[model samples]
Target: MALTETPLLFEFEVVSSEDLTFIPMCVRFNLDRFGLRISLAQWQLLPYEDRRLLARFPVDDDTEIEPNFDHALFEMLRTHANVEPEWFAPEEAPAWRNVSAVPGGVANQAGLADLRTPDIEDWAQLAPFQRYVLAKLARKPEANHDFVPAMREFGLAVPRNAAR
Candidate 1:
């Protein structure tokens, strides 16, 4: 049987930076529980030109729906496909708040003046990264450009202007 034909698979967009020149980019993934670990040396092994070229996303198929990485194929191709988990952005990784950054003025960043409401429940229930963004916005009220947008986008904040 074929590989994509199998069941246990899923996908998500992975944002990354080789951090070389700072041209932001993204990659598509067809994921499985089995992991792949790629190294900078492995990446560097490519010809310098090839390395640069590979860092770029293919324009023709810019938004590809990658097939789930089939386990059978993974088992068959494990030796050749030493996939690395390095490509995923920290945002996509488990949400780990940067303690040193000190985002919010108070402990409950999401419960800020504009963000909070009687309808809302526990602020601590939010994901750490979600709390971090809101916390940062709360600290520098001047940087509230995305404050309402972030809140509404995440479905966490009900607009003060909206009628209940």
Candidate 2:
């Protein structure tokens, strides 16, 4: 028999389900970043304190979450923010090569020295997967302490009075 090509691998379709509505940490992060600008009328439509709380999330160095949104959160976001229903592209993502290594340059900043552990230059040589892992870890709301530290290490913004 002649050799045959490998299979195309499993195929699947992703559909939204009624049981859950989800947004990833990174998307949440970006939404909170440039999403809150609004006329007072639109702002008033938001649940009291919910808009305030949403403003802080997925962004380190802001006040911690002190309120939660209703199940209508996704709908609220669409109405309040001037973004398309499904996609939002704020800025070009960090270039792959530029993002290749850990942002080793941040080592010299205050409180940013911890990422330099084991060896000072070690971070600059991390593999792409390592960088990717760090990137995902960098976006989690619960992991803001870790993320902001990395952000500072990368010369990215750290929230005001972030030392807390």
Candidate 3:
């Protein structure tokens, strides 16, 4: 029998004025109809220990249903945090020229020394956004372990830098 992998659902909260004010424009538009505004400084005043409690509130599944502002307010007293801005950017983006050319394709300057064809092909197959992310990760000195495994899983042949 095969075990199914469950998608991880992160329980997030908007628990402070800072979190409320800092929410991205997209989420802010959704929250505005309920007349909610979160301020960052207000959130800083709360004790850190109580912050996680905000996740106890379950998210509603209805796309059309508005968020419960009163509940949102209560949660804010202890729970909101901002998502990293970088997560929203395209993966293979910040469009720039490739650093070098291998037999079949080009590599970004960051990936020049350790060229791997299968890896290049695998990366090429991804959406430009995803390619951007892999390229960025590959170039990071601290990401060597994680990057190699990800490359192998994507069916890419290891580059010469594998031993490094």
lDDT of 1 by residue, 1-164 (tens): 12222221111111223432222111122221122334545444434433333334221211133233333233423344454343333234212244333233432444444555423233455555455445544565353444555566557565446676
Which is better, 1 or 2, measured by TM-score? 1
* Candidate 2 segments exceeding 4 Å error: 1-24, 29-74, 78-89, 95-99, 104-113, 117-144, 148-164
TM-score to native of every candidate shown? 0.30, 0.26, 0.31
Give a tens-digit lDDT track for model 3, residues 4-113: 14211111212222233333222332233334454545544444433222222222323245344335545555454442111122223133123222222224322543
lDDT of each: 0.36, 0.36, 0.36
Backbone clash total for model 2 is 0
Where model 3 places Cα greater than 4 Å from the true spot, the runs are 1-78, 81-122, 128-130, 139-143, 159-164
Misplaced by over 4 Å in model 1 are: 1-120, 161-164
> Best-fitting candidate, measured by TM-score?
3
